[model samples]
Target chain A: MRYELYYWPEIPGRGEFIRLALEAGGADYIDVGNRSEEQGWGIAAIETFLGGEVTDFPPFAPPFLKAGELVISHVANILQYLGPRLGLWPGDEANRLWAHGLQLTIADFTAEAHDLHHPLGPGLYYEDQQEEAARRARQFISERLPKFLGYFERVLIDNPAGERHLVGETLTTVDLSLFHVVEGLRYALPNAMAEAEQEAPRVIALHDRVRDIPRIAEYLASDRRQPFSEEGLFRHYPELDSDG
Target chain B: MRYELYYWPEIPGRGEFIRLALEAGGADYIDVGNRSEEQGWGIAAIETFLGGEVTDFPPFAPPFLKAGELVISHVANILQYLGPRLGLWPGDEANRLWAHGLQLTIADFTAEAHDLHHPLGPGLYYEDQQEEAARRARQFISERLPKFLGYFERVLIDNPAGERHLVGETLTTVDLSLFHVVEGLRYALPNAMAEAEQEAPRVIALHDRVRDIPRIAEYLASDRRQPFSEEGLFRHYPELDSDG
Candidate 1:
């Protein structure tokens, strides 16, 4: 069965995590929000689910997946549900849970990355909270960034299966999500990541490997892939980035 | 099999969410972090997993549950695993996924609540970022708090099962977690929750219902339950709270 992914059309936000998994898993799915008015699907399609019509299981936010009768929201939840179905999971309950934990960590890291540019919450624009955002970015670059990247680097190094993958001997959605996170960090905070990546060589290698995955490579080069922008989660405002 | 839960011993932070589920589910478990040194457990027990001995499946942070050989991290993941086993879940695939989705939203809400005092991230203290905390608290109380509470309130009212539970006809882990969120809000932002609760009567009623659950009532009165305090997630800082 084909899946319907509902997210904001303009940016490669959290939805991109699921998109990478869908592409890497080689599943048949449509990015609903990206479709034009002629194709009969757009932001309105996403709003319909959030517009109270589907009251029983209303998604609180975008980046929800509609698979048959299932509407899964939250990036980690969607990835966990899609992982096994798309053959992106390790196929064991234990490893699946482990991968989900890593995905959750990545989610937390991504939230922090987003916060670096909007430290006062999304209710206000980044311009309104530039001072606070700059301070947050400094602390984030000096502390949180290293802590999370180092943790993933350790996870990769300590993987009993080997250092190549995060969970098992094969690829899982966690790897895909991590790859996006690394790309996001590099794109959003080039100077900081250039320094940070030095200590996380293994994570960088895994990111490179994920990029080389034929399906992900094609999707990255295709029109379906949206570019990162200030409107998305990992925004690059040079003022909120540092190399310390 | 008895489950072993590992988290920070003092505060009823994220770990309390998992604790409530274990108690409500009537599962036999050990709160490893809360145990005494004489009992051969404490913070060190939690550190063991983080200390790198468990190479194959290391948890990024805690409130991790060890059930037999499976180690589940993240409050939602752990509850989702235990919900079916302990009969706290709705016992259907769709409703279970819905419940998990709600739990994930609660997780996001909880993080925001924590951030009200730590808007600069946990690298600094509330005293260090009191001004930013005040700004964040205003946004949280005026905006984020109501958005989340209203969402849950709608979820409760929209439940096809009835206006009782967040997921289905019976109490699920989502209800338990939501109850804690309400309690935390009321404790941390009494002035704000008093006004916000007006718009979320159904959610408030659900919290009351959770409080009356026989198992949960007994647990609340027992020493096993910790009190909300300044050191925990829901710190009662009057300066950072407002009715509007």
Candidate 2:
């Protein structure tokens, strides 16, 4: 069954998390919002979903997935729904719930990362809040980002199953998500991230290992993988980067 | 089975959501962090769990629920786990997922509410970032808060079952959560919430209804219902509140 993934056409945004899982698991899915209207997919479809013009379960925003009759939204929610179906999560209630909890924490981490560039709110431009952005970024890099990444590092090291994965000692959706978070941080705050990863070697190693997975490697090299830019969650504003 | 809730003792925090569900469902549970060390439950218990010294599936933060054997964190994750067992959600796969999705979005809304006051991360005191907090609060009151609350408002209005609930017509956990959001917003941003609710009468009505439910009403009236204070997720600062 082909799943329909809807999100903003440009900028990886939160959609990339769901995309990575789909890509790594080799699921039959279409990035609907990224496709043209001629292909019967576009932002209009997403608008309809959000506008409550389509299904009864209206998504509050994009990054929603349409699986047959079900419309699931919220990055963590969507990933949780897709994780088991795509064979990207261990097929067990205990492990699936654990992976989902990790995904939710990752979602929290990403929102904080996004706030580094937009400390005021998404309504305001980065330029409008550059001073606030800089201060926020300083606190984020020095405290928040490192704390979060380090937490995941500890999770990896302390995993009872093994240090290989966050849950069940196998590749799960959470591992894929950690890869995206680490990747985004590296792009957005290169100096600070380089230092942060030194303290979170296990997390960094997981990032490298996820990137090397055959399907994920191919997807990264392929044009389908959207590049990080100022418009996305992790923006490389040199001013926002605290030199490690 | 009795449940154990681990969270910061002084503040309601995210654990209140779990507490509300347990209260409404009349589940036998212990607020572990609030218990004394003599009782074998305290902040130390939480620290042990989070340190990954006891549980293999370590929680990134508190507000996790400990059932028979499952230790679940993330407010949404814990709620999803209890929602089924406590009969707080639809039992079927599709509706259960829909409920979980709404819960995750509520988690996002709660995070935004928290950030309105602590935009620079929670490490620093609010005064250290009061200026940024003011700016963030202004943006949040004008743009983010209403947008999120309004989205739920629309969800209440557009529910296929009826305007009485967020998921299926019965009192799902999401409906209770919506009530809490409305309650928190009213306490935090009285003027803004009053104005916001005008455009969301149905949501306001739902909040009122949930508050009046026999179980919830008792819970709210009892000492167990912690009053909103500056220490909690929704803090009332006259300056931060807008006259919207």
Candidate 3:
């Protein structure tokens, strides 16, 4: 089955999370928005996907996945649907729920990271709210980053099987997402995340292991892995980072 | 089976969404955090409930529902789990997914509403970022209010069963959440919502109908229905409500 991902083209943004799993699993999928006009898919094609007569399951926003008749939205929900299909989640119901709980935490962190640059509103330019962004970035760098990372670190340490994965002993989409989140944070808050990593060695180690996976390694080496930039969630604002 | 809900005592906040389904279905449940100290349960009880070391399924935050061995967090996830058990969702898988999609949209709107007041960070006081709050509220009141309400209106109108319910002819949890979202927008953006409602008659009608449900009527009349206030997600800052 072919999976079509619809999201804004230029930035890795939320779409990258979905892209990471699909690429890692070597799934058959197309990045509809990222393709050029010559390939018969672009921003216009993405808009048409959303515009075509709306269904009851219509996505509130992009970063949605369309597989056959099924259209799933919300990053965590989409991943939950894709996890088992791509062999990225354990088959057990309990373990799936545990993985889902972790995914929800990752989603929460992603939203907070986005707010650092656009605290005022997404519709407003980042420059318009740099002052407010600076304030929010401070709280995120100092309090939230440690608290959230510490919570995940404790979860990993508390895993009965070991610190190999977030849920079961096997790799799940939750682990891949954590890897991306840590990567984004490093780019956005290099100094702060560098210090916090000492408190979350398990999380950092899991991230490294995910990168070592052959499929993920190939994807990262290929052009599909979009580079992080100022336009994305984890933008580097010099004022927001500190060694402390 | 009895369900125990753990959330902060006072506000109708996120917990209220869960409360609506339990109340409407006449399910046996306890709002554990709101129980009086004399009754041996209060905020401390809620804290203990949260802090108790548990297995991997533990909720990261409050407003979680404990039913038998399952303890679910994320308001939308909790509602999705309850919707089936409480007869609040269509039994068919497709309809269930559609209902869940609607609930997720409500959750998104709720997050946007909360951000209007705390544009900087939830940890900071609203007074510390009033300027940014004013700017954020403007976008929410003007742009988001119409878009979300308009989407719900379209969903209801497009429902194959009818416009009476969000997903089907039956009253799902999404309907209750939609009612609350409308109530929130009205409280936060009286002028903008008043005007936008002109284009979203179906959404308005659903909100009115949810209020008239017999169990909902009793819940609203009872003290369990907390009034909207400055402390809650929907705040009536006169500066934030405007013709824009």
Strongest candidate by lDDT:
1
Model 3 CA deviation exceeding 4 Å by range? A54-56, B37-40
* Deviation of model 1 at B67, angstroms: 1.3
User: What's the candidate order when arranged by decreasing DockQ?
Assistant: 1, 2, 3
lDDT of 1 by residue, A157-191 (tens): 88888999999899999999999999898889999
Better of 1 and 2 by lDDT: 1
**Residue pairs with backbone atoms closer than 3 Å in model 2 (clashes):** none
Every candidate's lDDT: 0.90, 0.86, 0.84
What are the per-residue Cα lDDT tens digits for candidate 3 across B1-244?
8998888888888898999999988899989888986786778766665564654555667778778877677788888778888889888866766676667778878988899989888888888878888889888767887888888887877788999998878988999988988888788778878898999998889999999999999999999888888888788888877865
TM-score of 1: 0.98
User: How should the candidates be ordered by lDDT, best one leading?
Assistant: 1, 2, 3
Better of 2 and 3 by lDDT: 2
- Badly placed stretches (over 4 Å) of model 1 are none
Query: What is model 1's DockQ versus the real complex?
Result: 0.84
Q: Judging by DockQ, tell me the better candidate of 2 and 3.
A: 2
Candidate 1 i-RMS: 0.9
**Highest-TM-score candidate:** 1
Each candidate's number of clashing pairs is: 0, 0, 0
What is the C-alpha lDDT profile of model 3 across A1-244, one tens digit per residue?
Answer: 9999988887788998999899887899999878996887888776665664645566778888888887787788778888888989888766766677678788888999999988877888888888888888888888889988988888787778788998879888999999999999999989999999999999999999999999999998988778899988778888777754
